[model samples]
Target chain A: MSSVNDIQNEIIEEFNILGDDKESTIFYIMELGGKLPDFPENERIDSNIIKGCQSKVWLTAKDDNDQIEFLADSNTDITKGLISLLIRVLSGKKPKEILDADLFFIDKIGMGNIIGSQRSNGLAAMIKQMKLYALAYQTKQNA
Target chain B: MSLNVDKIRDQFPVLHQEVNGRPLVYFDNAATTQKPQSVIDAISGYYKLDNSNIHRGAHTLADRATRYFEDTRAAVKEFINAREDSEIIFTKGTTESINLVASTYGRKFLTKGDEVLISAMEHHSNIVPWQMLCEEKEAVLKIIPVNDQGEIIYDEFEKLLSEKTKILSVIHVSNALGTINPVREMIQAAKKWGAKVFLDGAQSTSHLTIDVQELDCDFLAFSAHKLYGPTGLGILYGKREVLESMPPYQGGGEMIKEVSFEKTTYNDIPFKFEAGTPNIADVIAFKTALDFIREIGKSNIKNHEDELLRYASSSWSEIKGFIPVGIAKDKISVISFNIREMHPFDVGVMLDATGIAVRTGHHCTQPLMQRFGLEGTVRASFSVYNTKSEIDQMTEAVSKIAKIKNK
Candidate 1:
């Protein structure tokens, strides 16, 4: 029931003290990616595909009771983990709720400093894509 | 290996430093070569002394800056053996230069059903712009497929050339694969069909000797960074006639002769394409880089790089379970390889720990990586400053990593 800001705050808290070392950061991200909720098969296609990212992310959303539930999977180990992190904040929320999630919370989470420029850009792209999904879902729900 | 490796290394201030607790081994020359102190000084000196905008400035500083900026253009014209200084246009980099032609020339000249012929081994920069252009113009993008050895299939390329072919843009050297394309032959063939050719000289400009007159390409594009100049600067060499004919890419100050609320005339050839405040410092410093290359002589640099490549090939190839990519007959100093059962990133990390800077992953040629059925490759590209001893260290480190990872 929490807004996107709350979810972002939770993500920031979760990312606290993820180490400065590249290997450590990678390991932490991998662990985070592994913990993401499983996505439904039916909802996965077209819009979920990310073009430039090194990771293969499959995103799916379902209306879980009254809330929006997101299931995201990635083939690349670290990237899959990134998908999991996205799911934590973005999943099990309403379309408007997810859309309202504060992206700037990444900096508070210490993930901003940890991730490379490319990965950060990828994360931003991921957030954007997910928001678009949420917007689409909201439109569909209204329809 | 005629280059005084020690002296050359000393010239590059960045190369002398330590990274990750080890002496830096810069093999990421393909991405961007480390600039020498002379180049750095030149850039700083320009800003320090003559920091005014060029062409229009009546002041002493303005006149000096303008003279130096145009001098680089003159130097670039000689560097590529272009017809005139006006033929060389300053761009942000090779990517921008290619996009300028693809957008402007493609828009003005090419129509529906006109074909844009490109090689299969092209970088994404070369591929995507044309793809965008083709989509916009309803034109066709026909690729000249590579052979097993990663060289272009000459027969296939020859067959594809037709009256419909409006443009043939190809990489003079494949960045990912290190395959030196037979652009001369391809350009000659394309010329028969009256097709204009744009050579992506991003990789070749650093290693191979380029003579636009000799290659006879309509346009040639390369970045200064790859040639030991500062980053954020590139040269776009186009035939004066062809450049004059094409519409300007950007509309702004410097690129225009007259600016009004009504119809405005464009500036002459080079400036017509170069819009806004140019990367003056980097462009001026690039003259030194060009001069540096000329002093070394292209053949000598090629010989040294070739030797290093040969040594690495012999040494690294012998490592158990080490798989080398891009075994083209004609190549510059790029060596892309993967180890058995080990991720390229892991290998890169291990190499980086030893202070060896190598590029990992698809190298921005994801489509090519998909074509090769590879996730990524650990790339060790060489320059004049790199040594056999450095390669030996790289070999030892790679062998140990492969053994540990595979086991």
Candidate 2:
């Protein structure tokens, strides 16, 4: 599997090429969401739900061979696409790497210009949830 | 006489600015209107010249402040055509006005098994207060169901109205759907059963000509912000008898006549409800908003907005996959719609990129959203200052967004 930085670099390169066209960037993000694998229906419960999002997002994570894998789904296409970006860059990485990653690509890609302020808050929320999952896994492994 | 659109637009300084790269197209009037320079200046003027605690102050500034504060009440009294100035009570906004009624008038009058009737199109402010009161008093809350077009079913409302229905509180114009409810007819019907009627005029005050005597609604509540006034100020109009009979909402400085450990007496009708220090500056400046509306005339403003609504409704209908949510025949200048398979939030984001501000969501009416089988809608509501060209810009952007699906 690719490292988190490698995936982030790839994303940054793709967004940079997309350039100042906000619409195309949004469309591309939504397309990425459409490509996300179907999250298990049984795992989509209240416990996995992310709070403070305008749209409902369910996220579940698992620890496999010391790597963290995250699965997420959102009712809205743009929000779903947003979470897919997180999953793609952070999934299949060590919990500590996932926690420590700077996520510089978000700013480099001008994600704020596309998502607007409120959705940026939702993006922040998704990041927080992912970090929480990483912390949970790190605790379980230590115990 | 037709309103001078350019001259009217010039009054609002906020409209002259740019958002992002384009000129701001503010279509979120239903949420809150941008204040005119006159209203803004009035607010600043109050602080500059006559800033003091109102009601009882020995200083000269106090006398000036108290007169200005009371002048707004008289202006509001004339604006709504209330019989007496004492009937108008100033609260924070529409939410506080409704909460005050539910707490004071509702709690004392309503009892177990009594019913409180509300329309499905009510804002959460109107709904939640009654729900809390119902739970507390063991009263049943009945809703007047709205049809697909977002108009209330008058037959259903008639059937629901009975002696058990103690209160019939309905929205005069729905903030979400823009449906102009038949409150006059509904109020007349409710009075037949000896039920008290309240009208939530948050959306209506700016759009329609309100003569409280003509409608005969026992209580009318609205916010100043929606009428191109300052925020944090609202008017709750109750009939003199009703205001006199109800208990004071809160026990505080202004609401009391005599206070002691042994016994305490409440003040007069309006003072009894307005507790503590009110939103003094905002309330005083709200008179300028009323003056602005009166100078334009409500009918002329309505005519201009109606033209915009008609033009927009017809123009937007041509767009592909454009599904209009609330298509009531009689409505204010508000349109709630969705493109098939497109989320309202995404539409809002795209619109913002074009410097167009539209409210996208349930708009604090979740039950109404549920009734329409929608999570939310993209709502574009207009005011007097909005232009046809702005509507053109919005529709063109929306058309392009809708086309994204086919591509």
On lDDT, the candidate that comes out on top is 2
DockQ for each model? 0.11, 0.49
B131 Cα displacement, candidate 1 (Å): 1.2
What TM-score against the true chain A does chain A of each candidate get? 0.77, 0.96
lDDT of each: 0.84, 0.92
DockQ of model 2 vs. true complex: 0.49
Encode model 2's per-residue lDDT on B245-329: one tens digit a residue.
8999988899999999999999998999988999999999999999999999999999999999999999999999899999998
State residue B53's C-alpha deviation in candidate 2, in Å. 1.4
Write down the RMSD of all candidates, one decimal each.
Answer: 5.5, 1.8
Residue B97 C-alpha lDDT in model 2: 92
Which clashing pairs does model 1 show?
A4-A101, A33-A81, A39-A71
Interface RMSD of each: 4.0, 2.0
Question: In candidate 1 chain A, what residue range of length 10 has the lowest lDDT sum?
Answer: A18-27
> What does the lDDT read for residue A117 in candidate 2?
78
Can you tell me the DockQ of model 1? 0.11
